[model samples]
Target chain A: MRNRMNQRQECRLTVGTLTDAMRAQSLLSASAIRSEIVGADGVRERREGCGYALTFSCLQEGQVRRILREAGLRRF
Target chain B: MIYLDHAATSFPKPREVLSEMTRCMRFYGGNPGRGSHSLSLAAAEKVYACRRAVAELVGSRHPERLAFTLNATSAINTVVKGLLRTGDHVLISDMEHNAVLRPVARLAREGRITYTVFPTMLLEEGRSPARITARLARLVRPNTRMLICAHASNVCSASLPLEVLGEFCRKRGILFVVDAAQSLGHLPIDVEEMKIDALCAPGHKGLLGPQGSGFFLLGEGVEAETLIEGGSGYHSLEEEMPAEMPERYEAGTLPTPAIAGLLAGIGEVRRMGIDAIHAHECRLIAHLARRLSYLPEVTLYAPQYQGSVLSFGIAGRSAEEVGLALNRMGFCVRAGFHCSALGHRTLGTDATGTVRVSVGYCTTEAQIDALADAAQRLCRRT
Candidate 1:
């Protein structure tokens, strides 16, 4: 169990908007992948707005990207 | 006062809606999508949920396709000014509100576009859909790029057959845009089924949200230029607006509290079932029309299609006088053109307009009865 947990790594896919990040999170969850939206703090600077991304397991990165691209999200 | 001017704005918003707004302002009054803090995320989630709800209401497969706007008027303006290119020709119904009329007219006057008015009034003359389509077939120029119309008349209850119009636009490769100002929550709308490229509606009237809430639902493959450009809470480094939907159009801070309230309002609407609401309101309209029809002075407009609204005028009395008299009787209704000059012109009541009694989900039969009695009393007094 410890070795498996150590082997797993975290991967992030930046989706640009908080809504899209949440949407990606939903799609991943439906596909049995758990993801978290992180990095949304930039308003204190005010010069640059915040950016968000979906953080999930490295094993699910490829599948997540495919799903998001198919859904016409984060196409760039 | 018994509020019947639902076509203008619904009064006595659902309790859930009110509480949701209050909760938003009280608990998590933070700018949505601006930060990762719990409050901002909470607000963002609320806004996203509202977007999903509205998209579902409009039959959109992608929630991202819907964008929050000031009202149906702003949404209509966004689509008209953003979607149509210079030299494009367009068609609108004879019964359109000024929301559709003014924008189209301004574009025409600026030499950016040309337009024609299709005769929806011909439906009153017993014209079939085929006849209506054929007449529109003649009006469509080579440059005709769009057909914009109201889903239902604001001043009356007449609704255009969206399926037929959608089919007509599809065959001709014209964008089908609808202003669902009066019909969004009152009637069922399926953007995909109707081939509607874009739908604009207010959150206030049928959805029972507060005044500053509205949305635009875009069908698949619909594209438009950004009407306004500012902070989209994303891609701040780039000059051009983001290429994706919602964020692409929403260039400023959204009304989080209003959107949260709108979400609750839509949920309530879903719970009550739109069909049941429509049936209840129509029954009331029918009852009132029946009573008012007995009065020789009352003239009902589009009597066959009183969906959730009924428009009538009293003989030898202006709509204003009748409306004021109804108000004095503790009944609230709308008089004059109701911001629908084209509709009034189509009905040939442009001179004095008509008294428009629009209903909502909460409107009661007793109110309708009292309004009918008020109408009768108005005739007797005159």
Candidate 2:
């Protein structure tokens, strides 16, 4: 079937596209609510939006003890 | 497995049904009229094709005249809520399920709609046709706006004399609505031929489809406004709902996969032919009823008008007891009111209820024999 407009223009909205848009909106909301960032050597971590992230991979054994004490908690 | 509950919902759906539904879910799974993509267009086409197919099956002139619903109950609700208001009267048969009966009762209690229930007349053996017609004509009232009846009784499988009732409604200008949940794919129905203004059917039942799919055929001149509102995909710019036939009634997202399965089910029915299926069920009912009559303990409810169901009660045994015993024997049976309290009362079996053994197209002679044997064993135990 030939239309006055191009093939893509002729059909702007279809079933698949609408469902994709609805699903995308849902994913975007989740992305905005919580976030996590990772740095090299498994050494650094950051938490965004709601809570704090504790980094401990490359720190000395004694340094971890001091950080836990300052946060008012002990690691078993 | 022996499937005798096809009257409730057909089991062992045609292989094509499952395959086609899977195809829709995999390749064309998209919200209809809600997007702009190739897959979405395919999904919309599938839904539209089903609508057109269903409309043609029920003698609807236009596909848009019919509206898809969750089940027959939902369709009935749309009609009851949208069209009826305070002071209007709705008439229904005594054989109605709680789906229709309870809603009407609530309406009556709140003083929204004055409702009347007409009795279902039974025929005597060797009775003439004229006697049955006269019995139905007496129920029509001047204030009755709608006359709702089941096409066939779920409790007894008695085929109603809708042709005669249709004539009565035509003369009185009453809107004749049929609750076709029990009859729709098991029996041939043409709304125009039967003078039915609206027909409600469950897709999961006789239509041999998934549970969430059902549609109502709206006859000409039945002006039912939408019971719900919001997105209809076509007229998104309009703040108000669409004024078109189906779009007016349909709001929000439709169950695409279920409707796709329903369309496939209808296609299977078309191929096998509904008349052939009906004939097969009638034969099964006849055989079952005849065998049941031989047992002294069996109390056949509707011996004269056995259609697709054979409802009976074992003397001295409660319906639930018999149902449990039958279940242990690998036979499934439904007992109690079957959600038709009025039907039970009208049949004079409300106190004890009755064991209903309904058959469908897939029911075989072996299953019927098993049912008869199970009843005999139960009868002996009682």
Candidate 3:
């Protein structure tokens, strides 16, 4: 249960548009860093014009950012 | 079967197109720009090559300026909906396909923009490019923001003088957009030389690729609002669509396999040469026109401006009836309005659309003979 709770601790990465968010999600998934598209209801303030966010585990935030940077993605 | 509806979509795509699409599906069935893996990279590379090929075909300076869409309609919609603002005006030709007409018309209906259909006489035979340019200049209004016209009519196959129009638009600071659905691979188009602002074309038609593959190439200093906004694989933390070339317009997962096929199709077109293909289709049209002209019962529409397509009507038979009779004899021809009510209106055949026989790269003299013979017999029976 504790491990499950830890895995559920999510962190969001906001992108400029929906296309970039999807791209970031694809990169994260390929790197084995699980992520989900958070709806505008969940990340309204953080959402860019695309109105979505890639939510991954807090533990994977560093790695996700690194991967996105390596892929030449700009994060908000 | 003799497939003469190349205007609708080219049948029997080049062998390389099929092979390349199959190879991509089997070997690298990965989402492009989605990840950094080898499969993703490979898919991205193939998609990039497709863009590059399209850019090269149109003489575009940058491959990144091209955005792949589902078809020419979608590409045109991206420009029409994204470029024009409320109260702006546009100019189009009377010979435009619905692909160009409907979107612009809808905007006008919604009271966002107003448009005028330039008279067809501008494109009529014997009108020099200079005269057409001057006539178009007269049609432009102070609010005229853009001019959109098809490179060639899908119904009557009337080739528009795009270079002259492009030059006129450039001088007037009016954006020039071309719907190259019928002319992309059948005729040579130089976006740079023509000063074209944006060009839209379908890969499935003249390019000899599968359906669901089309693109829009943008010229320098031209930008439009994003029509469909979603994940673009970059600038992931912004609340707005990215201010980029293709990523600004291309959203969601692209059709990868179809794009792969389109890349090969472009390659084959390059190898065969567009001029050769155009010459062959023109020859076929010329033969068909000559034979049909001898038929007293057939009224050929715009036969003098024959390009790759020929439209005609029988005296006693509807376009549909003649099309059906020809189909029964195993010749595929498109009947009815050919999705261009505006074109039919110009041809005075809006009520009874003309039968459109469009030839392709693979269409032969023998096929043209067969079509002519079938039409002659049908005319006699009627």
Best by lDDT: 1
* Angstrom error at residue B21, model 2: 1.5
| Cα lDDT of model 3 by residue, A1-76, tens digit | 0112234587765545444555566668789888865543334433333444567788876787789878767644
Off by over 4 Å in 1: A1-8, A40-50, A74-76
Question: What stretches of model 2 exceed 4 Å from their correct place?
Answer: A1-76, B123-137
Going through the candidates in order, their DockQ values are: 0.38, 0.02, 0.06
Could you arrange the candidates by TM-score from highest to lowest? 1, 3, 2
Q: Say what the interface RMSD of candidate 3 is.
A: 8.3
Clashing pairs in 2: A13-B35, A13-B36, A14-B35, A14-B36, A14-B37, A15-B40, A15-B41, A16-B40, A18-B35
**Steric clash count of candidate 1:** 0
Task: For candidate 3, write residues B133-166 as lDDT tens digits.
Answer: 7677788899999999999998876888888889
What lDDT does candidate 3 reach at residue B265?
A: 95
TM-score list, all predictions: 0.94, 0.81, 0.83
Which segments of candidate 3 are over 4 A away from where they belong? A1-76, B122-125
lDDT by residue (tens digit), candidate 1, A1-76: 0001124587655455677766777777889989877663344322332366556787776787788888777442
DockQ score of the complex predicted as candidate 3? 0.06
**Model 1 alpha-carbon miss at residue B157, Å:** 1.1
Better of 1 and 3 by TM-score: 1
The pairs that clash in candidate 1 are none
